[model samples]
Target: MNDKKLELECLRLISDGSGIGYINGIATFVTGLLPGETGVVAVYEAKKKWQRARLQSIIKSSPERIIPPCTVFSGCGGCQLQHMTYEETLIWKQRWVEDALSRIGKLKVTVKPTIGMEHPWRYRNKARLHRESTGKLGYFKERSKTLIHFEDCLLISERMNRWIRLTEEFLTKGYPEIHTLTFRENDKGEGLLLLEGVPTKALSEEENPDLFEALSREGLRSVWGSDSEGNLVLIWGEEMFNQTILDMPFDVSPLSFLQVNSKQTDVLYAHVLAEAALTRAETVWDLYSGIGTLTLALAREAKKVTGIEENPYAVEDAIQNAAKNNAIGHVEFLKGKVESRMMKIEEQPDVVVLDPPRAGMHPEVVKRLLELKPQRIIYVSCDPGTLGRDLRLLSQGGYRVESVQPVDMFPWTQHVETVVCLNRKHS
Candidate 1:
């Protein structure tokens, strides 16, 4: 009857199952909306084809709604499901994976309950903070180029939070522009912030003598260089403090691609090992094995393990890690693309563990793997869309999906890491 009531009906949430709000045939994703709940959405921008709306008022709240722990839950864009209860979040995520597989991949495999973290909050061991000219340090807004500043992040480790506070103080000293700051947590829980950038004209040696001293006080390591051509030189500290390096446990470099969540990585690795079902006489191939995390694990079970990676630094680190762990004799590192280098292997592995990037495996890589036809293929994917596509191709080559388990390596976000076990039809 009134203008406000008329606007409410225009945006009806047909299904709020996957954090997506369907309004007038267009999917409008909102944070707090739940299924069967009614809300007044404010339309900010409208086009002839579709409309975008924000929740104005919750006329009815779903039972799934819960109190958000973080004060900046909505604005931070760090955690997507913080508003929803943890139990509800897990249920929805499982359903999301099942729906994606059935609808997108056309597969009928069972989707197991999501493997949740014991401690969900502050699980991230790494945080990449972007710096703007305005002294604001935080993540970029979703779909926007602007940055949203924050003092502390609930998702980062406690040591990283301390570093963020100290870095904020350092930035207030009228230093030059800093493009990005990557924070890493060692096994000892010590935090290191790698500040990357060239010394702009605004930054002078005499102006900020406290930069290095402050970093030392905060126990933060500094690495200076342009984004394109600069080495990660450890200033004021050793290269690694806790985790293994080359073959011994040590700290990883800022440029290295270690798992963001340190605690859950052990669990994820165990799952991959179980899926592989390695034997002592069989060889194993770890594809895209960064820093030999999976390669080292595989060597413990298999007779021998060969890891292939494109990055020479990662391959070198993997070699060092293997030697340090006393697994070097059983493991070897090859630096190259998997599709091209896999052909050089004289013996086919009994198991192949694929942990590709978010883009998933290339078509040629998939073709080669299917041709090799290993006894078991363990696909660890970060993106469900590409994972599903690749799974379909593997299925075409007679590899049946045996089991699919979703691991919540990253909590609060829509991103899910899944490990699928596939076996050859005849094997």
Candidate 2:
């Protein structure tokens, strides 16, 4: 195939973060192009069936196209749909979820309208920045190995932005071994920092005692450092950073999994609880529970809530969260793999809530659910590809997907969070 500068119209935005077009009957997937837009593309990668191209020039732009506000919009992988309006992104996200359920899962169910954020900017509470050997600190370029250096990121909170600058300055001085720096802020207006570097090099606190003190005084609740093995060691501070979710206080560690958007998380959890429709007499099992965000919420209404998680740190945080919230009697946290624990559950739950990672639920867990036959299941998924596959298996295992609600947790990005409710039919 020869490179051609032919006019092509983009078909649709696919899950892999690209727009589809046809050139000489060969499907082309290119970034920075939207549906209904006509652009001239330069073919870069030609495969047997589909080809990847780079946009040369836009002859006709889509109505949804807008001037992105980010300085590194094209290079940074932090966002994908910055070229389109927020409303259009939400619509496209919902459609993608529906397409996965229908085309991939083979389920003919109504996918409810997407729940969007009123104000979508500067909502991210965490930033993981890559540091170059030359002391350039920023995010990695989209679909490439290049690191795009920046003084600040527009997506994270204003406070975290300044903290990022502070870390960049601190590392630029003498810490050439530090490869990546991560910062996270919570609702309490406090933040934490983690420094990760090469395996051979160790984090030396003695070298930068004054810098550590200054960072702690600058509002970092705690500072941690790590090497290639990815284990965190406390460098300074004893502040137990706590964040409130729906009026319950939960302790957040340096590296625990958290929903990046704090405000939208309130909205997302409300939908999950609503779909649960608990009667205050049900026993609920929250699988893959992270810091008891959903477990504590469910504990308020359910008779008993048992949460099983893989992270021991998160499990400890969950226990402290339950005690801190003074709602311990109704909730319990167990540390282990959820798959192995699923088989040992002698007392079946009336409801099961799964907020698994992007990979979705495990096959063994799905198999165990078929055997347990829980009355109801609420699955919150971040990746639609895995979500579709799990829903297909659950549907085959006698569960029916009742409602699908898409939440725009990370606005201006291609990622979307979905909360699905499934009910089992009487056999």
Candidate 3:
């Protein structure tokens, strides 16, 4: 019933952080309700089979429940599991992966406990914030366009928070054209700013030399503005900045994809390398390789590693990174779609590594992988739903899932990064 207040017990959390409870054989999803907790909820939308509700009051809270450190944690869309203890979140993350594998993939496999951070807060190396008409920079409320401003965000470093405040103050003066601002940082505390809008007279370094100089002086090594036409204009400093992953230096542009949590990235990549167990005899193929981070890492032990990526800027960076790392000899980069470029590849890989996007690998890419039958396949996935779907297809194609390792790459969020290793089953 729409707008009906009812008491219900939360059974479990769904993929999107909503607690699911059954009411008369129908499912009721409520936000802010944790598992093992009973709460009164106001059902806003009711369907024949399911309903959506908002938690009104918690009759009983879970033992894992804790006060979120961030003042705007409840309203901000940046984090989902802040109310729960970090340990409980890790357990739930592992279960999420296991549930996906069992339900979606129909493959029973052991999922290791989620690898988590010692200090999860302030781990993110990137922040993309929305700017309101009033020049307030913050994230939107969960599932709403209503922007919520905060003095600080727990996920990003304090320096980044200052940068956001500075940028917001600048925008407050004038520059409604700039609607979005992205700030990226490296381990070295170097920052990069991306302003998504047309450069205005106020934004020009020639006119506002002090503003640009101030940003540069405040640890911003590079600043860029991109318009609707996808044209990037350098506002200040160098075009490329540096980031080190696993003791390897990478030239990262504002556009390149990088794992946000620098500490957990090290843990994730180290686990992938251990699972790969390369012995310098096998040829490796890194699909959907962005800037050759993993590809170059694989090259250290594999006979040869080829990276296939679509973004031209990322490919250029990967080429330069390979050269800079002295991995050029064993690593080669191909700029194209993985599904299409894989067809033209002449070398048959002994080991295949895939780090696809949230949408997962293309069907054609999965089909070709089955046809090629690489002896071992290691998949790094961000979305468990898609990972399970593709894993089912690969399982049916004569591959056996060897192991699943879930890593808490995005702390305080429902997102979990997983690394799966599968082997070709022999007849």
Candidate 4:
């Protein structure tokens, strides 16, 4: 233990696996280890508290280890389980949610098997690439500022991969210093790329005419401007082709908080709606409603739906989307935090749908929901840790979890989305 550079062999990957190895009695996170594999990890930094290490070499390889499909697998920090087998990856993700609920939520409940994607690869409908000063476009390194240049990303759709290649060609042809690129795929399979950068003094509309022309040739719908104030403005497009609809139609702006996986979002929304079981007489309240996706969906079945959101822009967009869908009469937009605004509502809803952020519901908000005491509650969560914690609190206040279903929103990733339906326990 007193050795300056101790070499420890990594045996297997544990639950908190991110390819980070562990040194016995050192408690340091080291990378480059697979389950049942043996690798010598060199401990460089150590304290009376803990130790850190880097993998020197792989002494033995695990049978479960497979060659990563992405060339930039280790360099690009976008994916952690690229080296893991698909079946193993799914098992670990399901265990992660179950463990979070048992340890964090401290409740006894059944966590059903995860619903995985049919084709795990090419499931990502959107991707964000960082452009460095050297004109290299890729993802950032793990826990570092270094950019790992990549020609193709395995997680995104094939169309997005093509767009990256096309953008790289554009950059080589005297395009300005681009900072970031956001790709979004519509339901029709067309893509829109939003480029952000500071324009050079000599650059002009005439000089960039060919850039738009090239984008059009590649079948890209449009290209937007990352303006001086860091705002996204439309530079060129058909205007009509610039829109994207999730559950409702919204003028897809660069800053809007749309779901990254477009295909999975449709599935996610459908599951959420089914769990809510909205009826003609039921009035539903949707908390943390972003752009009225779930609100609009629920409005179709319920008599009325009131959506609460914090972002002013998103609330405005939600109202516009409601009007666009002709559901304005059925859905009302309330702009504010759930805890504060719930107290002032004139009427209590029959059912409440809570889809809070990763941090989960505020304790006060949970308490207020119990006070309001809706007949049923459907909780949709991206973070299992927070969801489990909130479920424990809800269970104590006369709510019993009817069912919990896990959805694979992010394929080939550790993230899992769960929808929990809770009904008031009858006497």
Candidate 3 lDDT tens digits, 4-70: 7789999999888789998788899987789999999988888899988889999999998999899
| Model 4, span 308-424: residue lDDT tens | 988775787788778888896879999888788877887888899988999999888898888988999999998888998999999999899888888887765667888889999
lDDT score for residue 273 of model 2: 95
Candidate 2 clashing pairs, residues 3+ apart or interchain: none
Tell me model 3's lDDT, rounded to 2 decimals.
Answer: 0.90
lDDT score, candidate 4: 0.75
Ranking by lDDT: 3, 2, 4, 1
The TM-score, computed over Cα atoms with residue i paired to residue i, of candidate 4 is 0.87
Residue by residue across 203-296, what tens digits does model 2's lDDT show?
A: 3447777666666666777777766766767776654777778877788887678888989899999989999999999999999998999999
Q: Which segments of candidate 2 are over 4 A away from where they belong?
A: 1-3, 197-218
Clashing residue pairs found in predicted model 3: none
**Model 3, position 181: C-alpha lDDT score:** 85
Tens-digit lDDT track for model 1 on 292-396?
887887887889989999876687777777777888677999999887888788888788999999888988888888778888999998877788888888988
Cα RMSDs, all models? 3.7, 2.1, 1.3, 3.3
The top-ranked prediction according to TM-score is: 3
Best by lDDT: 3
lDDT: worst 10-residue window of model 2:
196-205
Give TM-scores for every candidate, taking all chains together and pairing residue i with residue i: 0.89, 0.95, 0.97, 0.87
